[model samples]
Target: MKKLLHFLFHSEVPDINERYRKVTSAFVVIFIIGYSIGFLQLLHLGPYLGPGLGDNVSFQPLITSLQALHSQNPSLWYALIALLCVTVSFRLLVMLAGYFLFEREEGSAYPIKWIIVFFLCNLFSTLTIPLLLFALATLFWVSGLDFNLGWQWIDHNVRLANQLVVNHVPTLINAPAPIAVLMIAIISGFFHYWFHRLGHTQRILWLLFHRPHHMTPALMQSTTMAVFTALPLFFFIILPYNLIFGACTKLFSSEPLYTEVIIFNCLILIPEIFGHHTALYQIASRNQLIRLASFISGGGVYHYMHHSSEPEHCGRSGAVNLVNIGGGPLFIWDIVFGTYCPLSAKTPRAGLSGQPELHMNPIRLTLAGLAQICNELYRNPSWREKWRIVIGSSSYTPTLSTDFAIKSNKIRQEQATPNPATIKNFTFSAPADAIASVAAKPVTGPQS
Candidate 1:
């Protein structure tokens, strides 16, 4: 176990030249896994097991119409694929633009290899892992265990709320599909803001999951996805929003919420991609207008500022200033909560303060982060902690400190400088006894 921890936490940094190959391999592996999951979903090989698993009875007409459209016109599939391709291509182009336009110092600029690695890391952490977890949760549900752990109670309440709205509220039930979709998006975004905020302020969550992203020495476009966290924690991080979305869908509309979700996600991605940009691009004439847009959409310079390693931007524990700018698609939450940091504030240093120059490789870094969480759990035996871990509690004691960094720096500086004080304090003693004094006396005759 010790050896494993050492391997996970103490792996040597890879050479710059080798990083590209390593990163590419990681991407390929995650892509294959993600693709397989998607393929299974499309084939309906996996049972759709959840609260709303077979609740499409009210949307049979819409489902039939979609099925008929698919049966009549195969070209629609091709068109949809083309549209997805175009959207992805545009996002990639924007990332490239940010990379080139940003003026990064030679030392600080991310190498092509590192950028690829970071991008793939983010992809796996954000998309692939969450998808896998959702699938697993569904599988668990099919086996008759409510795999939701901490979320089951919340899910039950949400379902009840949905039932009330759908069966009781005639106006909401009759609302237009677009309005329903918009409401879902806004509600989901609001929850996401809180989830992110809680992740930072909560000690155990931050140490196990959130700290890795902040540990990076520099920020690049790919840094947006570089969340180093336990896989289980990743599942918990995303579960609330998914549950809330499902509830809203069941409550508000008969149409399949999947399409709406895709659209909302794509729209949200626009700001997210730009927010991760290294260069600041002024989007409007007035700063207030820009802030307002960011507040509404949950993107822009404020998000970038959240990544700042400076104490002011982030708390002493390295969490982003929760009092300001921790929203998702809406910054209004931050404003209301009094955590709204403006973009006009001076750009703060990015990454963890006093971060080590030499760090573990990406894969090891991830494993190490998880290992730390397990170790913490083992040390503290409490049902509450276990429940929190299972249900994704966003509270814990803050433990990360600058003491190690300060001590390491002090040692390095001491090693670099000779201890003149010690040398100056050195003194030679002579025996006071006549025989010892004669032996210790200087040989004056010989010197002469």
Candidate 2:
């Protein structure tokens, strides 16, 4: 027990930052092609959904009406693309100063096939998220809990107290450009921090939505995979933000809120894109603003620590990796909650260390987390244990050892057994290139 506890929280210093070799021309070519495809899709080649709400209660039409925002009503294409471009470009720019992408994968296009699916899923999530949230809004509306109604009642006459707070604190709707952007960052980041933490803390949530992301060993090609969530988790993550956004539309009756929203959605997500890359690369910068921003936002070294699942990085219970949990324009919440792990010399490995299936196949990996939960449910026959499995901390062990899950995963692995029956049984066949997505695939590409 003492050894187990020590293994869980043993924090030894890690190697200093690694410098990756120059990327091959093929990787550059792949990125160019990918970006071109996205640009074309943005320009109407992509499928567009009709506005979700007929009455425009969610400001659905106003967002879809904007050409820059994409065809889907209130789509996040603008923000999504901005994040991709900025993240990749920022690292590329930092290339003039330091290496970020893995040096071993320079000559490889092997991961592209696996990486593209997540990229496309991210696109899918952004476009469909608004529509999904309004469906949730409709559900909440039926429950006598319309956030807009409550907000409207409070803002009915724009009372003196409300006005003072609006003027002083920058309400989501009425604030000027600079203040409004800051407010959006805080609000959106606040939601992201909690939701992200929730996804980690709860076993059900970790399996259902977060596991697919954590399965990727490399963060470089897969950073955009963040938020590749299913419909249920999609509603969970965006509902509160949408509710607040809807209520804010009521705040400014005269000025157009859509324009500000376009700006808000696009600009406020800088911190969201900022942190994950830090998972793999220790960005070197003496620029005080950049340094300070990373420090406050938990973006640079701090957030990189969040990805570490090594026993050395885990907490005393060995159940959670509680380092640098803040993901925001400010990680002040993490500081307040005592979950912040400052970026130090420890270079933690990303991904599950000893998992059977690292979830290389996007098709299988997407729901694999839920499958693990279900396995746990099956292993624990007792109803009380089952209930605890869903709601309990993710690190909570079941009555049965997870060796069953490990063996089941191994049996299902394409390489392990080459099981066609397994492949055909899944909703989608595992793609051929999944094998190449593994970290062991060499830089010259796969030996196979």
Question: lDDT for each of the candidates?
Answer: 0.46, 0.43
For model 2, the stretches where C-alpha displacement exceeds 4 angstroms are 1-101, 104-173, 221-224, 235-241, 244-274, 278-280, 285-289, 296-301, 311-320, 353-359, 401-448
lDDT score, candidate 1? 0.46
Candidate 1 residues 1-448, lDDT tens each? 9999667545554546744655644554454344423422221100111123223223343344446546867676455445445545545665555544444422244555455545545555555455665676788788887778333433444455456544543334635756765664555446656666656655456555666565544555545444523444654533444345455555566545443343344444444545555454333212444444444565655576666655443222323334344443455555544454444334455555444452435554444446545654565577676555434433332232121212143221101111334223322221122123222323222110
TM-scores, all models, native as reference? 0.57, 0.54
**What does each candidate score in C-alpha RMSD?**
19.6, 16.3
Worst 10 residues of 2 by lDDT: 45-54
Tens digits of lDDT, candidate 2, 402-434 = 422122523331111112333232222122222
Q: Highest TM-score: give the candidate number.
A: 1
Model 2 whole-model lDDT (C-alpha atoms): 0.43
